[model samples]
Target chain A: MANPTAALIIIGNEVLSGRTRDANLQFLATELGALGIPLREVRVIPDIEDTIVATVNELRARFTHVFTTGGIGPTHDDITSECIAKAFGVPWEVHAGAHAKMAAYYAAQGTEFNAARLRMATMPRGVVLIENEATVAPGFSMENVHVMAGVPRIMQAMFRALAPKLERGAPVVSATVHADGVFEGQIAEPLAAVQRRHPALDVGSYPYFRPGPVRGGVALVAKGTDAADVAAAADEIEALLVAAGGQAIRGEPRLDDNTTAKV
Target chain B: MANPTAALIIIGNEVLSGRTRDANLQFLATELGALGIPLREVRVIPDIEDTIVATVNELRARFTHVFTTGGIGPTHDDITSECIAKAFGVPWEVHAGAHAKMAAYYAAQGTEFNAARLRMATMPRGVVLIENEATVAPGFSMENVHVMAGVPRIMQAMFRALAPKLERGAPVVSATVHADGVFEGQIAEPLAAVQRRHPALDVGSYPYFRPGPVRGGVALVAKGTDAADVAAAADEIEALLVAAGGQAIRGEPRLDDNTTAKV
Candidate 1:
């Protein structure tokens, strides 16, 4: 069976302005991959209403799940909730449960539940709240679209809470075979042949350059839902590397394992 | 005048699979922003030919410029060049100049110029080369779409070489005002008013949470092509912060810079 597919949208002007680097996509990608949902696409866009609304609608229609991070704060730039509501053609209003939670939380902290803070309670009608134990405001799920905060800690917390609720498919298993001093060009044809042999698996070759002892090398990875297939393909890759006059390591090498490289 | 817009396509499975964190997007964003070109959108997609071809065609048609990184290596997964050629409906073949360069580079390194290595010389018809001083294989440009390597060092080198050839717009200037211990909710309305006052500037508010000494804070940034306008809006934001009973700092805090935030 094919794994469920997902798309991620990262919304923030800070990221587009190069003032901040996004950390959410990779974290989500790793988690979703483990849950048997393949992330097909990820887009980093600025916090603009038209762009956000269009992107949200497009992704939600294309992928089984769409996760959006950023622009859920209590500030002028925090327009994600409203844009999402607009995309679904739903009325934007403050959810009573979310409002009550934020109010109670702020009261306990001795902070006033001001109008600006109250904006966090706003969402599209009929959306369930995504829990945020790390922060006061909570993310919400409207259909397949999940909106979460941009902060790393808050985003992580929301994702952890939301992951269990999502539907799972067959989890992808991966195996890596590392070869030292093996130029990718020298073994490309054999790698292609190996890939052709296992048409169901995704075989990828990544080259890495290191200074001093380990000049450079390539890592061949085989990934599939079937662990046996992935392992078998990995073995074939190892054999191919050995036949090419290079030593193939069984697994990914640690940084300290550079001493095993043949100069 | 509005700046020329650009879109970026990150092509790799390692990034989508979460094995490798992407380092090219931010570098491109910063460089594009400084050169007065706004990076409007960035999409990270897997190393699939159909996806690459469709994405390349869509982006090249929509944006003034498109930059793609990854999958331009000498391996089975390196299909970006052929996919790009297919997208343009042009025939793909080995460029004599590129082939000569790669052959000479390999000869100097005492390596045979194998068929796989020769793949690096392949490109779409009527395309110009983007030099890669860090590596032997040169990237290529077919009209507005610029294809480069996935490695950070090589990508940077290619971008540096290509930047001077692109048309430059008016550079954006920015000013930031940091307010410590200021809850964003307390000043959201005032910030919105300030934003309304300067329609040309891009006003953004980013919240920060620190331990021990500083509990939480927010940075209000004003960006625009006009320096004086950006500075004026920043000053107004600082005044608004002080009016809301918060200690406003002129510049962003040092050291407390959240390095843990993902890039």
Candidate 2:
């Protein structure tokens, strides 16, 4: 069976404005892959209500799980919670658990649990709160959609808290073969033939450039649910690279380990 | 008047699989923003033909310009060119200019311009070629949609070639106020008030955490077309931070210059 699919909606103007480079997607991708969930799509959208509502609705319907980050803060630009509520056609209200937690946490800190801070507690009806140990404001899971904070540390914590509830599939296994002094264009045909032999595996060719004695090379990766199939494909790729008069390393070549003589 | 909007479609399975992190979006976002084009949306979709075609069509219709990176290689997974051709309902064919360029480039390096290598020359009908100085394979521009390579250096070159052809709008001006020892939750309300006063400007509050004695702080950014308005809003934010019993720096605080005592 195919792995469960997921879609990540990164909601923020900061990312779109090029002011902030998104760090959440890579973390989520790696985590979800380990959990046997294939993240199929990721949309980095601005802090716009209509766009958020539409994107959330579309992704939630298509993928098995949908995760959102950013725009759930105490500021005016934070409109993700309300947009999510609108998407589900539910009334946006303050959850009792979230409210109590935030209020108590702020009281303990001797900081005012002002109206703006309290806004973080708001969520759609029938939502389960995702714990945020990094911060007081809790993220929530509404059906298959997990709404989390944009902050990297906070988002990681929330995902960890919510991960146990998700349905996992067969974990994907991957193997890489790095070919020294091999141009992707030169080896593309042989690589494609190997991929054709292993129809079940996902084969990818990524070229890398370095500023050293060995200037460039290609990394061939084979990914699939079946370990044997992935290994077989990697073996085939290694054989192909050797036939093409190139030295194929078993794994990714470290930049410092560029001892292979250039062809 | 608002600037022309653009959307970026990042086509690759490697990124979604956590095998590779995307670097194209940030470069495009910064470049487009400087050219007075707001990068409103960015979608990282897999190298699936139907998904690519549908996404390209949707983004092309909605935004003034659309840019796509990845999947334009000599490998089996490189289906972006064909998908783009299908999106525009045009025949996918080898461009004479691209074919000649690749053939000559490979011949110069004493490499055979094989069938798989020639695949990079395939593009949609009526497309203008975007030069790739880093590599021989040329990216193309079909109407407002610019299709480029996935490699950062190659993509950068293609974007630079295409930038001169785009409709440039008024560049956005920005100002920042860094508040030392100020919590985002504490200053959310005041920041909102400042945002309200300058409705035309885009105001954002981003919290930062440091490992040293000065633990936390907030960076208030005011962005807009009007320089004077941005400066005025930034000044107001500085005053508000100072009133809240914190030190407000005019620009982003360099960590080495953080001599200000913690509150």
Candidate 3:
């Protein structure tokens, strides 16, 4: 089968206002990569109900799985669950399971569960709770859409809990050979050829800015599941770089290990 | 008047694959801030034309302006202009003005205008070109939707060109007062109170991770265009933080200068 496709929806006004630089998208993208699932798209919408409904409905129709990373808080702007319910035509009410969890949390803190805070317990019909280890309010999964918390810690915890449950393909494997003292344009053509040879692997070039304004090298990364295919592709790419008068540094075997752990 | 509202649609599948860490969202967010046009949301969708058209319609109905980046290049994935035209229900053809710009760019590069390259010149009807100083392919504005290049360097140039033509609101100003040795939960109540006091100004608390595993502290950022109001909110926020047994780091004065330059 093909790679499992996913999309992320980051909902908040704080992100767009420059009030916060989003760290969630980067985290989810890398994490999804490790799970052998390719994240296909991401959208950051505000607290608007109509916008949320429209985006969720459209994405659900296209992607196999959709993950939303905000607007599930206790505040009034946390309207994701309600809007999602409206979109799916599901009756939304406080989930008995989720409400019990929230009540216990508020009770433990010796705080009264106000009406506003109770909104956290509301969920779409027939959805399973994505157990939240960081907080009391659990995220919910409706069909293929996983609605998680906006808080980074909470979102991370929910993702960890859900990873094992997901259907994963052969995880995308990658190897990187770093090059120094070569311009990107000089190697773009040869890289294209390398890609053509290894249709199973993705060959990519990334140019970075270094000191002294030197024409810094490209990091040729080959991504796929088959180790032999990945290695062969990487070797072909490195050979081309060397032929183009650039040093291809074969560093540690674990050069792309972080990406492996990220998903 | 209310802040000039805008939205962004990032068209690409590469970004979602973790192959591309998006630089456009941050660039456009900061640019919109400088122009006093508040970017309320951002969506990254695949190369699907229907998704693009649907998103454009939804955003155009709500926002004062919509800026779409990517999908305007020579490749097959670049179909933003055609999709946008369909969204607006207007007949799209290669604008003579845009074609002239593309011809001049190809001439400068000493390359023939390949048929695939002409795709860049296709634009929606009744729109004016947003001059591309970095490259020959011009970005265009059809009604309120601005179609621009996806490349970071080119997007920045288009933004600079498009800024003067937009009607800006009173510039939004912000002040940050950092509190060391505090937790997010510890300050949530006081932050809420501060927000209640200054409804017009937005106050946000962001927790940072220290070198150690400990939660470093929260940065209390208050934003608004009114200098006096922002200052007042900042003063109150700092006082509250200090009272909560946290060290307050005085943030910079001007809010507009806080953005990181991309191009």
DockQ of every candidate: 0.51, 0.47, 0.22
Pick out the ten consecutive residues of candidate 1 chain B with the lowest summed lDDT.
Answer: B254-263
> Which lDDT value does model 3 have at A197?
83
Tens-digit lDDT string for candidate 1 (B1-263): 67888999999988998888888888998999899988889999998899999999989998889999998888889999999999999999999999888888878878888888888898999899998567778898999999998888888989999999998889887898887777687888999998899999899988877675657777789998899899889889989989977888987754243421210
Candidate 3 wrong stretches, greater than 4 Å: A1-4, A33-36, A48-63, A71-143, A149-154, A169-263, B89-92, B101-105, B212-214, B252-263
Per-residue lDDT of model 3, residues B25-83, tens digit only: 87777768767787888888777788899889988998999998877765444578899
Ranked by lDDT, top first: 1, 2, 3
Off by over 4 Å in 2: A255-263, B254-263
Candidate 1, superposed: residue stretches over 4 Å from native: A254-263, B255-263
Alpha-carbon error at B65 in model 1, in Å? 1.1
Between candidates 1 and 2, the DockQ winner: 1
Docking class of 2: acceptable
Error of 2 at A132 (Å): 3.1
Q: Worst 10-residue stretch by lDDT in candidate 1 chain A?
A: A254-263
Q: Candidate 2 chain B TM? A: 0.94
Q: What is the two-chain DockQ of model 3?
A: 0.22
> What would the per-residue lDDT of candidate 3 be over residues A147-206, giving only the tens digit for each residue?
997767778889998888888877877788866665444565577678788877766555
lDDT of 1 by residue, A118-190 (tens): 8899999989999856876889999999999888888999999999999998998899998778878888999
